[model samples]
Target chain A: MITQKINKDNITTSGDTAHYTEGLQEEQYLTDLERQAIDHEVALVPYKSAAVIEALKIVQHHRRWISDDSLNAIAAYLQMSPAEVDSVATFYNLIFRKPVGRHVILVCDSISCYVMKYGDIYKALQEKLHIKFGETTSDQCYTLLPNCCLGCCDHAPAMMIDNDLYKDVTVDMLDRILQKYS
Target chain B: MERPLTQYIHPGCPPFDIREYEMTGGYSALQKVLKSMTPQEVQKLVQDSGLKGRGGAGFNTGMKWSFVPMGDSAPHPKYLIANADEMEPGTFKDRLLLEGNPHQLIEGMILAAYAIQADVSYIFLRWAYKKAAQLLRKSIHEAYAAGLLGKNILGSGFSLEMHLHTGVGRYMCGEETALLNALEGKRATPRAKPPFPQISGLYGKPTIVNNVETLCNLPHIVNNGAEWFKSLGNGSADSGTKLYGVSGKVNNPGCWELPMGVTVRELIEEHAGGMKNGYQLKGFLPGGASTDFLTAEHLDVKMDFASVTAAGSRLGTGTMVVMDDATCPVGFVHNLQHFFAQESCGWCTPCREGLPWVEKLLLSLEQGSGTTEDVELLQMHTQWLGPGNTFCALAPGAMEPLQSALKYFREDFEKHVALRRCPYQ
Candidate 1:
C-alpha cells in the first residue's frame, strides 16, 4: 500500500499516504481495491508521482475509463495537479481518457500487418460493428481503435480485445471472437 | 547449432516453469558470478565477448556497463532496466524471449544488475503484451520465493530489487532517455545526451537501460565465456546468435535464433520457408520499420550491424518486414510514415511537424493526388529530417524507409504521379 504518504488531514497527500488510506471514511471516489492496487504500484517506485502510469492503469483496470473525476482523484492522491496527471495520461496511446466499452479492440496497422491485409480485417470490423475507428458500439460492448504493432508481427493482422490477443485473425474469425466477448 | 537463448522454449506449450528452467541450467551463471567472479571480471568477459545489443542499436553491452559510476562512493540505488518496449513494427523477437522463458531473462537481468552494481531493476514492458505480463508476474513471484531475488541474493552480500513496470503505448520510450522521462511520471520526451542514462537517469540517479534481448545474452555469455559466444556468430567478429524474424508474404513467417552474421537470403528462404507461393520478393526492410528498405540485390548482405549499415540500412531488431511484388511500394511506405508520424511524441518541431508533413505527402502520392513537386518535397523531407535535425532519432528513423523506397521504387512513385492512380490498385 502507499503507506509512505499519510497526511494528518485524513486525505492522501503525496508524503503521507497512510493516514489518507486508513481514513477512507467518506472518500468514496477511489475504492478500497483501487486504492490498494495504486498503493502497491506506488510502493514499487521511489517517488509516489513516478507511479502515475501504474496508478492510472490500476484505476482504469477497475473502472473502464478515466473520467475527469477519476483523474482529479488520481491527481490529488499523487499530489500532482490534474493537468499534470492528464499531460502524462494523454501522452500515452493506451490510457483512454474517454469512456471505453467493456472490451476495446486494438487492431494493428503497422507495415507488417498492412502487408498482410490489415485493411480487410479493419473493413470487416467496421461493417460488423457499424462503427469506424475510435468509435464504440451502440451496446457499449466494443471499442474499435487502430493500434500500432501488437508485437506479434509474425502473426500479422493481430489484435487485442482487451488483454486476449487474437493472432492471425481473419475476417471470418471476427464473428467468433466477438461472440465470445458479449 | 546450439540455440542458447531459445533452445528450451517449446512453442504452443506454456513457457518453462521455474523448476523446468532450473533443471535446464538456468541461474547457473548467477551461481558462477556469485561464487568465483567480481563485477569487473563479469564486465570484462562480456566486453571481450563482442556481444552487441540485439535491440536495433548494436552497442557493445560490456562497454555500456563499464561507463557506470561504480565503487562504494558512487551513486546508490543504481538502476538496471530491461527495455522490453518492442514497438518497432515487424519486430517480435524480444516477445518470444519474454514469453517463452521468463527465468532466463530474470537471470540475465540479475547478471546485468550485478555487473553495474545496480540496486533496483525494472522490466519496462509495453502495454499490448498482456500475456507476457501475466507470465512475468508469476515468474517474478517464483524468483522471489526461490531466493533468487531481493536482499542478499544467494547470500552474496549483493542485494537488488526487481519490479515489472508496464508502459502504456509510447514508441518514444524505446529511446532510453525518453524511457527515463516516462518512468519519472512525465511525458515520453527524450533528454539531452552527455549526461546519458549511465550517469544520470531515472530520478537523476545512475542507471543502465538494456534491451530485453541484449540483457538475455548476459547469462549465456557468463556461462559459456567470451570465446565460446564469439564462435556462435556466423564467422563475423560479431559474437552471439541473433533472433532473426521474417514477416509479410512469407510461407512460414517466424523468428529463429541464427548465427549473428547469417545472410539475409538464409533468414528469408530457409528459416522463414521463403516468400508465399504467389508473392515474389520485391524489396524488404532488412530490419524493422526504422530501417531502410533493401532490395533483392542486397539479399546476400550479412544480417549483422556493420554489414547492414554498409548496405544503407540498419539491422534494427534483426526482423525483416518483406515487401512482395504484389504490394504497392507507395502504400507500404505511406503506412510506415503514418506509424512514425503518430508516434513522434511531438517533443520537437522537426519530428512533430516534419513527420506529419511527410505522411501527408506520401498519402497524396498513394491516393494519386500528388504532383511531381510533392515527390520533390518528400525528397527534401528525407534530407531535412536527417539525424540531429529532430529532438531524437524518431524523425530520422522515420525517413529511412521513405528515402530508400524512393531510391529503389522511384518508378512506382513516378507512375502514380503520371497515371494519377495507383497502378497496383
Candidate 2:
C-alpha cells in the first residue's frame, strides 16, 4: 500500500509552466511498494537513475499516465531532479506522458509488417475503433498507435495490447483481439 | 543436430527444462569450467575455438575478452554484459535461442562471468521480448537455487550476481555503447569509442558486451574442446554453428542453428522451405534490413562472415528477409527507409537530418511525386551516409539496403520517376 502523505497545495510549477496537477494529491510521494521496488533496483546498480525505466514503470502501472506530480515524486524518491526524470521519461517511446485509454494498442508498421500487408489490419482497426492513430476512443477504452518492429517479425503484422503480444494478425483478427482487451 | 551448438533445440517442443538441459549435459560445462579451468585457461580455450561475435560485427570473441585485464592486475568489480537487445529488423535468431533454452544462455553467462572474473553480469534485453525475459528470470532463479549462480557458484569460490535490464523501445539501444548508456539510465545514445567497453565500460570499469549466441558457444567449447569446435564449422575458420533465419514471403519462415558457413540457398530453400507459391525471389536482405540486398543470382554465396563479406555483403545477423519480384522494390526500400528514419537516434547530422530526407525522397517516388532529381538525390545521400561517415553503424546500416536498392534496382527507381508513381502499383 502507498503510505506517502499528500500536501494540500493545488498548484505545481514545472519548468516555468504552472498547471493544475490532477489525479495525484498536492504532496506527491512514492507509495511504499513503489519506493521499495525502486530501492531494490537502485541497490543492484551503481547509480539511482539506472533504475529509471523500472521506476517509471511502477509509477505508470499505478497511474495510467504519469502526471507532473507523479513524475516529480518519482524523481524525488529516486534522488534525481524532476528534469532528469522527465527527460528520461520522454526519451522512451513506450512511457506515456499524455492520458491514454484503459488499453493501448501498438500496431507495428515497420518493414516486415509493411511487407506483410499491415495496411489492411491498420485500416480495419481505424474503422472499427472510429479513432485514428494516437487518438483515444470516446468511451476512453482504447487508443490506437503505431510502433516500429516489435521483434516479432517472423510472425509479421503484430501488435501489443498492454503487455500481451498478438502476432500474424489478419484484417479479420483485429476485432477478436481488441474484444479480448475490453 | 549432430553439432554440439544446436543439439538441444527441437522444433515445436516446449522450452527445455533444467533437468532436460542437464540430461543432455547442460551444466556439465559450467561444472567443468568452474572445477578444472583457470580463468586464463577458459579465455585461451575460447581463443583457440576461433569463435567470432555473432551480432553482425564478427569481432573475435576471445580477443574481445583478452582485452580486459583479469585477476589482481585487472580492475575490481568488472562487469560482463550479454547483449540480448535484438532489434535488428528481420533478425529473430537470438529470440529462438533465448526462448528455446534459457539454461544454455544462463550457463553461457556463468562461463562468461567466470572467464572475465567479473562479479556482476547483466542481460540487457529488448522490452518486447517479455517471454524471453520471463524465461531468463526463471532460469536465473533456478540456477541460483541450484548454486549455479550467486556466491560460491558450484562451490568453486567464484561468486557473481546477475540482473535483467530491459530497454523501453529504442533501436539505438542495441549498439553496445548506447546499451551502456541506457543501462546507466540515460537516453540511449552511442558513446564514442577508443575507450572501448573492454577497457572502460558500464560505470567506467572494464566490461565485456557479447551477443546471446556468441556466449552460448562457451559451454560447447568447454565440454567438447576447442579443436572439436573448430572442426564443427563448415570447413571455415569461423567455428561452431550460427542461428540463421528466413522471413518475408518464404513458405515456412523460421530460425535454425546451422553450421557457420551454410550457403544462402541452403538457408532459404532447404531450411526455410523455399519461397511461397507464385513468389519468385527477386532479391533478399541477406542479413537483416541493415545489410545490402543480394539478388537471386547470389543465392549460392556462403553465409559466413568472411564469405559474405567477400561476396560484397556482411553476414549481418545471418538472417534473411526475402523480397519477392511481385513486391515493388521502390515501395520496399521506402518501407525500410521509414524504419531507419524513425529509429535514428538523431545524434549525428547525417542520420538525424539525412535519413528522414532519404525517406521523404523514397516516399515521394513511391507515391508518384518523384522526379529524376529525387533519384539522383537518393543516390548522393546513400554515399554521403555510408559507414565511417556517421557516428555509429546505424546510419551506414540504414544506407546499405537503400544504396544497394539504387544499385541493383536502378530500373525500379527509374520506373517510379518515369511513370510518376510506383510502376508495380
Candidate 3:
C-alpha cells in the first residue's frame, strides 16, 4: 500500500506555467501494489525527467495509460514532483491518456505505401467499420489507425491488424477480408 | 505460389551482386535507363509519376532530385545519400529493402546518382542495423566487382563510388541534417532548413538525401517506366507497392507487401487475421507512435499521407501500433511519453521539462489520484510546449498522439481524476 504520509517536498510548481502545481497527495491516488512497483522500478533509471518518463513507459505498457496513483508513486519513487512526470507524459505521442481498443490496426501510408495505394486500404476499413480514424466503434470492437512504414517495404501497401502482416491488398480482397472480422 | 521475399536472402551472406540480383531481374532498369532514355527523360518520368519521399518528410522525390543543378556548368562532386538510419519508432520498412535486396537499392542509387551527376554517395545507416550495414557494404563491393558501382557503367562514363557508414544510434540522427552531422562525426542535431540538403548538404556541398525505400524504387521505375509503376496502384500517378510492418494484438503479426489505398479493416481482418480471442479493438496509434491516435471510427480513413493528415494526423513512417480493449490509455500515453522524454536531446527546455511533467500528471491520473486540474494542466502544457519547442521533430512528433488523446479521450482522463483510480484497473 502507498504510505499515508504525502511528502510536501515532492510537490513543485510547473515550470512552463505558474497556474499549475505538481505533487498531489500520494496516498490519495496510489494503491499498495502500484506503490511497490514504482518503488522497485522508478529508482533504477536516471535522475532527469527523461528517466522518470522511461519508468512511466514501463507502467503505461502494463497499465495502458498513466494513472494518478501511479504518478504519485512514481514521483515518490523517483524523488521528483508529480508535475515533472505529467510533463513527460503529455509530450510524447506513443503514450495513451485514455483506454484503447482490444486490438490496434496499423496501416503503412508512408511514401512507398502511398505510391502503392494505402489510401484504398484506409477507405475499406472506414467503410467496413462505419467509423472514422481516431473514433472507436460504439460496441468497442475495433480501433483503426493509419501508421508509417513498419519496415516491410518489399511488400508495399501493407497494414498490420495487430501483429500479423497482410500484403498485396486490393479493394475486392479488402471486402472479403473485413467479412472475417464481422 | 511465388517465392516469398525472405527467400531471396542469401542465408548469412549479404546479397549484392548485379548478376546475382539480375537472376531476380536486377539492373534491368539500368538497361532500360541507359538504352531507352536520357537523364532528362528519366527525371521527367519520375516527376510525372508523383513519387514522394518515403522518409518522414513527404517531399516530391523527382522535385528533390531535379534541384541538383544538373547541367554542364553545375558544380563537381555532387553527393547522393541513402538515409538508412531507420530509427523512427514504428518504421522499419527500409531494413527489409536494404537487407533483402541490396542490389535493388544499389541500382536505384546508381540511377539517382546518374540523374543528378553525383560522383560520391554514402549509405548512412544506424549502428544497430549491423546486418543491413554489412549487407550494404558487401553489396557495394559486389557492385564494384560487377562493374556496377565504381568508375562507370555498362560504358556510361558516369562514375560513382558508394560507401556505407554506420550511425551511433541516436534517434535524432534520422533527421536528414542531423544524419549529415552524425555522418560528419558531430553531435546529431538538426540544422535549420532552406539551404535544404538538396542545395547545401554533406560537407556544405550539394547533396540529395533519399530514403532507402525511395531509392529502391528507382530500378523498378527505370525498368518498368514511371507510368507502369503509377498504374499499379489505384490508377493515381502515385501508384506503386509498399511494405508494412504490423504489430500489436492482431492474431498474425508480420510484414506485408501490398498496393496503396488499401483500408485498415482489410489489414486487420484479412492481412492480420483479426484480433486475438476474447479481446475487442480499442483506439490505435496510427503511423507509429509519433502520429495521432485513430479509433475504430476512422478505419476507413485512407492510409495515405494526405488522407491521414486530412483526418488530422500525419502519415509518419507508416507504422501502426494496435491497441486492444484491455489496454489503458493513460498508461499507454505515459509509456510513450517516457520514450520521448528519455530520447529528448536536452537541447530545448520545453521538451526536456514538459515531457516529464506530462508523464507525471498522466501517471497520477492513471493511479486514480489526479484532479480535473491535472488534465487541464496537461492540456496547457501540450499547448505551450508542443510547437516550436524542440530542436528536431522528436518532441513535436511525440506530442501528436498526446494532444489527440486529450481531444478524444477527455472523459477517460476526467474519470481518472474524479475517481482517483483507473476504472479499467
Candidate 4:
C-alpha cells in the first residue's frame, strides 16, 4: 500500500512545527526511509533538482504534510537549496506544505463540472463536512478543495479522494463515498 | 468511421501484459521498422501520411520531425517527449487511449524516436492521472522485458530509453516548452521560440514533443501505409479518424474515434444521442473549453481543423463542452476564468494580471453588479490578450470561449445587470 497509516500520536507531539529554530542539524530531520526514497528518485533523473517534486511527494507520503525541517532534509539530500525545493512544494497543486485532514477530497470545478450543477454537490459536501475549499474538518478526517478538471469530464461532477477517483457523483452519493474513506 | 486506431482497446482487458497485445499484432510496426526501413524512409512515410498533432495546436506531425538535426553533424543524444499532460477542461480522450492500450503508444514512441534519432524520451503525464500513470509504467517495463525498448530489438542496432515523468498539476506544462521546463524541475513557464524543442531541448539536445494521440497514430501509419491512413478521412483536408467526445447533459456523453470530418450535428444527435430531455443546447464550445462557442446554426460545420477554423473556431482536441438552455452562460465563463487565473504560471504581465481581472468582472456581472462598460471591456481585452500578444497559447486559448460568448450571449449579460441579480435565478 502506497499510503500507510501515519502515527498521529507521534505527529501531534513531535514539536516539529513548520517554523525552523537555530542550531538544528540537517541530519536530525529526515528519517532513514525518506532519505532512501528521495535517493532512489534522484538516481532516476538527469539533474538532482529534477527529482524535487517526486522527492517532496515521497516525504509527504510518509509525513502527511511537509514541515520546514522535513523540507530542508529533502533539499539537503537532493543537493538543491532549501528555498528551491520550497518553491516547487508551494507551486505544485498536490504537494501539501501545511497539515491536512487524513483524507483530501479534490472536487473538480471546471467547465464540465459547472454545467453539471457542481454547485449543488459542493454545497452538499460543505454542509456535511462543515468546511469549504482548503479547510480540514474539525475531526481532521477530510479536507475539501477545488481542483481543475480531473479529466473525467465524460463523468462530470467527478472527484478524487486521495488517488482513487469517484465519478458521476451526486449529493445523495457523497455520504456513502465519504464513508468508504474515513 | 473505421476504428483502426482504437482496435486494441478491449474495455476490461489488462493493459500491463504484452502477450494479449502481441497476439493481435501490437508491436508489429516496431518490428517491421527496425528490420526493414531506414530512419529516413520512416520519416518520409510519416510526412506523406500528413498526420497532424492531436494536441490543441494542429501542427503537422511529420513536418515537426523533419526540423530536428540528426547524424554526426547534429547534437548527440536527441530526445523525444510524448506530451501526455491532457488537462484541457473538455479533453479526456488521451486518458482513454492511455488507460486502454499502452503498447500502441510505446510502439508509436519507438517509431518517432527512430525517425528523429532520439535516444532518450519522456512521457510527461499529469499528476492527477494516478491510474493511467501506474498502467503506463508497467507497460513500459513490459516493453523493456520484451526488448522493444532499451538497447533494442530482434537484432536491430537502434536503442531508446523511455521514462514516465508526472507533472505536479500545472496546465501551462501542456504547452511544449513549458513542459520541458517543468521536466527539468524549474517553474512550469513557457520558453521563447526559435530555439525550438527540435533544435535545443531537454538538456540542450534536439527534442521532438508529440501529443499522446498524435504518437499513437504512428504504428498504424507504418503498418497500414500512408495511403490507407489518408483514405479514412471524410474530407480532403484532414486525414485519419479523431477521438471526439461530448459532455454536459447529453444522453450518451462519451468519446469515440470517428472519421476526421464528422459534422457537429452528427456528433450531438447521433453519437451522443442528442441532448438530454427538456434541455435544448443553448450554445456549445466546439472544441474543448478553450474554443469559440458555436450556436445551432453551425451544426453542419465539419469537425475538422480547417473546417472548424473556417466557421470561426479551431477544432481543439475535437472534444465539445455543451451548455444547455437552463444553464447560466455568464456563470460558466466566470468558472472558466477562475480556472485560467489560477493556472496562469504568472509568466507574462497580460496573462498573469489580465485573466484574474477579467474573472472578477465576470463574477460581478454574474452577480448583477456590472455596467454596459464591463461587456465592452471584456470584448476589448479578448483581442488584447489574443494569440500573438501572450507568451504562449494558454492566454489566447482562454479568450476563445469568452470572446465568442460576448458575441453570441450579450443579452444574457444584459439580463443579469438589468435585474441587479442573476435573471436565471
- Interface DockQ of each model: 0.75, 0.63, 0.04, 0.66
- CA shift of B222, model 3, Å: 0.9
Question: What's the lDDT for candidate 1?
Answer: 0.89
- Which candidate leads in lDDT? 1
| Candidate 3 ranges with C-alpha deviation above 4 Å | A1-182, B1-17, B235-237, B388-391
> TM-score, each model?
0.95, 0.94, 0.68, 0.95
RMSD per prediction, one decimal? 4.1, 3.4, 16.1, 4.7
Give the Cα lDDT of each candidate: 0.89, 0.85, 0.69, 0.87
Per-residue C-alpha lDDT of model 4 across residues B1-425, encoded as one tens digit per residue: 57977876766676636998898888899889998998889999998998999997888888999999977799978999999999999789999899988888888999999999889989999888888899899999999999888985667988999999988788888989988888888878889998999999887889999999999999999999999889989665888999999999999999999989999999999999999999999989878888999988999999999999999999999989999999899998998889999999998999999999999999999888998888889998898889899998888988999999999999999888788788777
Cα deviation of B14 in candidate 4 (Å)?
A: 3.3
The model with the greater DockQ, 1 or 4, is 1
| Top-scoring candidate (DockQ) | 1
- Model 4, residue A108: distance off in Å is 0.5
Q: Model 1, range A100-173, lDDT digits (tens) per residue?
A: 89989999999899999999999999999999999999999999999999888999889998888988999999
Q: For candidate 1, what is the DockQ?
A: 0.75
Indicate the residue-level lDDT of B400 in model 1.
Answer: 93
Looking at candidate 3, what is the lDDT of residue B259? 64
Quality of model 2 by C-alpha lDDT: 0.85
Model 1 chain B lDDT-worst window of ten: B233-242
Residues A8-52, model 4: lDDT tens digits: 222232333332222135544678887788778888777788888
